[model samples]
Target chain A: MSTDALTLDRLARMQTAVVLGYDPKFPAARRERFEDLGLLPDTTVQRLHTAPLGDPIAFSIRETVLCLRREDARRIFVKSVLP
Target chain B: MSAASLIAEEEKLATVALVGSPNCGKTTLFNAMTGMNQKVGNYPGVTVEEKDGLLVRGGRKARILDLPGLYGFSAMSPDEAIAREIIEGKSAFERRPDAVLFILDGSALHRSLGLLATVLQEGLPTAVALTMVDEITARGGRLDTLKLSRALGVPVFGVVGHKGTGVAEVLDAAVDAQSWPRPVVAAPLESAVARAAWSDTVLQECYREPKKENRLSRRIDEFVLHPVMGPVIFLLVMGFLFQAIFTWAGPLMDLMSGACSGFGAWIESWAPAGLPRDLVVHGVVEGVGGVLVFLPQIMILFFLINLLEAVGYMARAAFLADRLMGFVGLQGRSFVALLSCHACAVPGIMATRSIPSESDRLKTMLVAPFMVCSARLPVYTLLIAAFVPERAFWGPLGIQGLILFGLYLFGAVTAFTASWVLSKTLVKGSLLPFYMELPPYRWPTFRNVFLSMWHRAKIFVSRAGRVILPASMLLWVLLAFPRAQADPGVPAAVAQSRQLQQSFAGRIGRFVEPVFAPAGFDWRINIGVIASLAAREVVISTLAQIYGVESEDETGLVDMLKKARDPETGRPLMDFPTAMALIAFFVFALQCISTLAIMRRETETWKWPAFAFGYMGVMAWIAAVAAYQILSRLSV
Candidate 1:
């Protein structure tokens, strides 16, 4: 709800952000999968690569890189980390 | 934690399951632990591959299972569900493992450990095998396994699977799992946030983060996944793969066929000409030869595919093609299987295993046979050369080339359209989330690549061969039985023709002629169509034999077919319309029995294969009839 709130998909490439949490809009099962995949609140995420056609993008979080469809990424909220 | 429990567990081959997410080096550890002592089975209902192998030490042995990779126990796909079911003892195919070897990718701790937390709560005896330690350390990360082990109250072994380091220790520790320490307090079961907090607390002292993402991978992706260059590169890679299978494998395949025929000739040269000799040459040798010829192409295809998968290029290829393939209600992996189908549908069907979703896999497998495969080329070539004139069309391209291109295009269009229809009607499912892990690229290990190729070859020979060879024998019997009496002073070739004309297959072909009359085929073409079930190219030879020409004399047979008259009307047998009809039917029809046999092997049920045959049969009939009727009417 803050002015600085950003959905992960909207975050620019290579921009580092701290996970604020997922939007409550995601169903319970998908939300749990998000957490189980290490996207917990306060986790650091940096947008890495976008697929050629630009739908699925890869992000580096917790020393691992995961590819997320742009649709799924639009649901996760994050905040920019101060340099 | 008693010695008696350990002794009793050893009496039976205690089972240990390797559990981890995809791209976590779990298979590498499985190969390292079990060496060549591995067998692939399927989970009870789902056809996902279950890799079973053995771990031996001193005097004891135990079965080690490589369950399909899992991100969590949420069961997103059939593969994930099978992994969950087997681990929970809910699977009827496999008992609950006596112990679990949890492979934790050291480089992907946040991801692997998060999953690990949920797995530990399964209440099974567990040991952690830390993999990707080298990847971590190379990237300026460090982990103290001893400290992490103490925190979790479980034994942890650091393993570099490709190098065979610490793999034995994990198994040794897993075998005595009864004595392994249990956690004092389990991971939080209430919520995902609570579990993440639990993992963070445990990793606070032991785990360190890699300084940054892999630079080499990023540099490669710059070109490989570029908006413009990415598609260009993918096309080049696929085009090159297509050419290699058709061109490079051609000679080797010829050599295999040549050897079978040469051996058959050598046996006939010495032995008395009799039924036994003919059966040995045609029934056994030729039947086995058909199956064996696929080995080189299979080996090459798997070798390249394994290399791509091992080097992590396949995931990127899938990422690149996802949107385009999605238009057909399938994902990018289906494209790979369909591409491979151009060479042959046997390996193409087998490659569908790479597809993650069950419905997608079945859809890909069913429609792949429609792709213009190499076997159909012979029929197309003979027909087009005879019927389609060689007049120039667009630029230097001849009309013949254009028609051939049209046939290939038609095949591809039908394959995609069929899959779209299937996605709506038969194997219906929304396009699932395209979840793929683009692992950091590494050199593909030769041992792993060779082992994978070997496993596929074995499966083809054992599973497909069991059905195809016996079926080939039956086809030969139908074409060879109830021999016509040899008339004195008659040429052997003509006498052979008489025998074939009245043989069981010939009778059936005539019986079915009325059914095919609408499609412009008579009994001779019907016989060729039926004989094609052995392999599509057999149609050429069957026609050659029907005209009493040597089966090897293709040109002679072509001339005969072009001039011959229909028995009743004395009209030319094959015309432009019939050629159109034949090509139309071959494009849509599933003619090869071997394809069905392999489909049976992959799906593990007769239902889907039967449905594929029946539906394709109807499609072929309608297309053939329509093409013939329209062309004949327009010319009139």
Candidate 2:
């Protein structure tokens, strides 16, 4: 596969992943970017689980569990997955 | 070079901007690089904090501008916009940076490199500082910095910011690369997908990660984040926090109180019997002493909160709180602002800058002052200790401790209610989605925690000296002057009371007494309330002066208040019902002048602060009246 095609596939998969939360490190800007994506559905809710640090969060997107950092979530193009 | 020439050269140092994603340990790196040679100010026309430090490498000196953390150059929040403008050389006050220290988190390299791609496109002489390499390696991940640097066409240094590892090399590289050509990516990633792909490719080449999940962190998080148990654990943690603030700090508070009293006694004995004696004893020592006694509580509170934040539990707490905050029409992000208000409303209001929505920011600021800040600790401690029984409840919890917790909870509930009301009526906005990074839990360093506590203590004490000292002196003058003609037959206590009634503060208190009458406040309480408008803790010191006791002798004030009578009814002045009413009143009152001033500055208008003060004042009065009336009837 071409690099662009692979990139597009990876991006598509990421876009399907539910956004758990933004990394608190760069809170405001990352949050703004996440909101701009407009990926979260009204029915979507935060799923919390135990991690060494505290509760690592996940978002319920359909039935898929895509555990990723908030920064990663920001890179996923929401427009591709929307509607 | 001559000394004059060297000084001149240092004055005109080149600029280096340290740019990074938030939570990438950029600040720790900046602190390690700059050490004590740093100055903090605000960006031009913006309240966002600007930190600059002098980095002297060999004979070269550069001013390092620690720009606010940003994800990309796209201006979103004020922090990002300000940073973007500075980096782009569009800032009116700052010139373009001569070099850029681009920091990336080693554990999250793929995501971080996305930002690096943007930074590289800016064409500045950039160097990469990869942070958290230790954590990455501990988690069975490997990063080849050399290869990554070669690929990016920039120098990459592996550094642990907190441990000061590999920092000097990074600084040297940053300073020496001044003449280096502006960085150009071999292939620019134009679209978002391309950028993600580019970052992923780089990560694939340079990094490796262990396949297994982190068991320890996961096990701990399971219990901490349980839906039903999470809130229960949070409440228990918070309850213990407040209780410890009272329990652990009692001895230190007594010691501080004793020292103040001893110092005042020395001053009284040394000075001749006159206005100078009264002024030195009552004004400076007594006034500042009352505040100093509460320093231990304030320090302990800050220390605990800082530890919680450093341990990364605060973010989880915010995530848990997001749902409830949503019900109040507020973003979970406001939780940070409210938490900051626990220390001081000035910083709390300032922290609202992190909330992206203008309406959310304003609403958060409006209700933030209602949080029981450290300033209220002195008053609450005094009132609770004086009025409430000290008997233990259910083995360990003292009634005083529980009452203290109740006061804090009361303030929080009132703040949330106020936010909901204001959001519905004045500042209507949609609740922003909660997105908070739960940071890795780490043991909080003693150095960091101590430094934080010291900083807070210094601010509190300085405020006492600067604002409270002068206010106390003014109160002393108002209370001490217009000495009544003494009838040689009158007793000293009676004579003092009569003299106080004739004084300026006493006269003003009488004038305002009728307004507070329904709230069960007398002329003496009126004096304390009026004086406390400058700062909440002033009420404690003002009451000491009104009761003719040294402010440090809090026990003496309590004893005096116990015996004190209403001039008309001859009943005890500070009854249980009245004390409860006073506590309720203070829970809602916007008493801090500094909070008001900061609100004006943050909102850039007097309209919000004025509205906050008027509404809070009215709410406090009504609450106080209801508590007094209801409790008095119940007691009867």
Which 10-residue span in candidate 2 chain B carries the lowest summed lDDT? B1-10
User: Each prediction's DockQ?
Assistant: 0.58, 0.10
Off by over 4 Å in 1: A1-5, A81-83, B1-11, B430-432, B551-554, B567-569
Q: Please tell me how candidate 1 rates in CAPRI terms.
A: medium
User: For residues B388-454, what per-residue lDDT tens digits would candidate 2 score against the true structure?
Assistant: 8789987898888988988889888988998999978989863333345555666665555666566
TM-score of chain A of 2: 0.28
For each candidate in the order shown, give its overall lDDT on alpha carbons. Answer: 0.83, 0.69
Evaluate candidate 1 by giving its C-alpha RMSD to the native, one decimal: 3.3
True contacts kept of each: 0.61, 0.05
Clashing pairs in 1: none
Could you tell me the fnat of model 2? 0.05
Q: Which stretches of candidate 2 lie over 4 Å from their true place?
A: A1-32, A35-83, B1-10, B41-47, B186-190, B213-215, B290-295, B330-365, B368-409, B427-433, B443-465, B482-491, B517-524, B532-584, B592-611, B625-635
Deviation (Å) of B634 in candidate 2: 9.1
Clashes of 2: 10
